[model samples]
Target chain A: MKFAIQINEGPYQHQASDSAYQFTRAALAKGHEIFRVFLYHDGVNNATRLAVPPQDDRNITQQWTKLQKEHELDLVVCIAAAQRRGLLDEDEAKRQGKDANNIAEGFRISGLGQLIEAGIEADRLVVFGD
Target chain B: MAKKFLFVNRKAPYGTIYALESLEVVLISAAFEQVVSLVFMDDGVYELTKGQKTDAIGMKNFSPTYSALGDYEIKNIYIEKESLDARGLTLDDLQHLVWEDEDDDWAEKDSIHLVSSKELATIMADQEVIITF
Candidate 1:
């Protein structure tokens, strides 16, 4: 099955993000095709690599980056939500005249159209949030 | 190919960004030319309420955008009757949303449908893609 995942909450604050990660991981392990992973609202916070957890705790952001790298996943962070949360890439940072870019590697900033396209193209569009 | 896409909204406006973000996705969905529908339930019923003034809250009044959904071909807007009754609201509490039927010489018609939970479930089950916010 082809799946498109939507995560709507930030890491640590809500378990939805972690569940979304686990679901995506399991889907890929089953040889299912992943259409895309869209991060919206506070979910865009997952794109920021600036968060640091305790040494023994799970690094949620890095986990996504690692999974994205291994699967070559098209992890998308909604640009509007990301900008509101200050999660930016180098281009967006430069365009908005910001000092830093904290978006994690392998996650790209895009518009809501990507989410719509995922709905249109994927067999299932699974959402995890409050 | 076009698919039946349904957006389920269950939150009140301003308390969280989900309501606004759902509308944002709805607008974008129009470009995909799919059969899209919206359902307002629970506190989400408050989202379609009329006379929403955000001046004190300092938030952009996006409530008017619901009025524009007709133009985007978002014709079916299901409001849960149970939710309205639970909140002590009637159809009059929400915005008078309408759409123009080109086949009928551009005559305006109501777009909002007050449906029972069973009807809402049928609508939901008919959709190929369901995204809740």
Candidate 2:
């Protein structure tokens, strides 16, 4: 099976991010193809490298960064949502006259069109949101 | 091939950002020329309600944007009847949304469909892709 994933909550404030991560892992474990993971709403916060947690706790952004590295997953953060939430990439930050960019490794900022294309191409579009 | 795409809006207008963000996605997807349908369930039905004045709340009044959806060439709008009844709302409470048919000399037609849960289930089951917000 081929799947496109969209997560719509912030990483720590909600469990949707964790659930989406687990579901992506489960799908990959079953040898299913993940077409893309498009983050929107507060979900773009998951791509912020500025998130720091206690040593014993899980680092949500790192987990996704590692998974993306291993699977070469196309992790996309919606540019409109990201900009609104201040999760900017280097280019986006520069374009917006910001001083810093917090986009984590393995994640890219893009337009909603990528999400629409994912829905068109993937066999199933799974939304992990509130 | 064009796929059957359904977007499910399950939240209210101002209390949460889901409704507006979901509308953004739907509007952007219109450029793709896909077969799209929208279902308003739960508090989402409030998004199409008439007489939304955001002046007191200091928020943008985006309720009128629902009427412009027909102009985007994307016109399927489904309102869950049970949800409406649960909220003490009826079809009359919503804005009169319509679309034009180029096939019939651009005749105006009703775009809003008041459907029961079972009817929505059938519409949902037939979709190739369903995105819930």
Candidate 3:
């Protein structure tokens, strides 16, 4: 099966971000294909390149980057949500006349249409959030 | 018929408009003759509790609205077991017969299903479309 995951909750408030990762790993282990991972609402925080977790904790950003690199997953961060939360990529920061980029490399800022597209293409669309 | 996964009630059914708006969408989807199923998870599960006293909140206790689902022939209602357990509720405490256990024998219920998180994932995987609140 091909899966498209929708992660809506933020990193701090809920366990959704971690759940998405866990589900992704499980789906991959099952030998299922992943179409994309769409990050909306607080899930956009997972795409931040500047996230610094405590020394004793796991780094979600780094984990996501590694997973994407290994599997070539499409990590899509909603552009509308990212802009509202001050998570900007290089192109968006330049377009909005910002000083620097904040989004990680493996992630791309995109529109909700990509979400629609994911739904159309993938056999399964799993949503993780509150 | 196309199986449309209509996610009704996203909010707590009081504070935010997401829940009500989602209901409208679900009704619309059902009107199209699509096979719709509803899952109440997270704060959205509050919408299912019976005998809600919304008077203090200056709002109508919309929990009764669930009873009207039968009128629309929208019988595929599913509630997360963990959600009800967290709130200290049972299936009898709800306005409608929601599933208490994911693997609970629901063959007796009329078009109603009780699903665990894992079952919900499988159902979601098989659906043609999903619209979250």
Q: Best-fitting candidate, measured by DockQ? A: 2
Q: Could you list the iRMS of every candidate? A: 0.7, 0.6, 5.3
Question: What TM-score would candidate 1 get against the native?
Answer: 0.98
Per-candidate DockQ vs. reference: 0.91, 0.92, 0.08
TM-score of each: 0.98, 0.98, 0.59
Backbone collisions counted per model:
0, 0, 1
Off by over 4 Å in 1: none
Off by over 4 Å in 2: none
Q: Report clash pairs, candidate 1.
A: none
Model 3 Cα lDDT, one tens digit per residue, B1-133: 3546556444688886457545644555555555667888767778777788978888766566666665565768877778777878777776754322234553334544657778877777776877676
Docking class of 2: high
Q: What DockQ would you assign to candidate 2?
A: 0.92
What local lDDT score does residue A105 receive in model 2, on the 0 to 100 scale? Answer: 97
**Candidate order by decreasing DockQ:** 2, 1, 3
Q: What is the C-alpha RMSD of each candidate to the true structure, in Å?
A: 0.8, 0.9, 8.9
Q: Per lDDT, what order, best first? A: 2, 1, 3
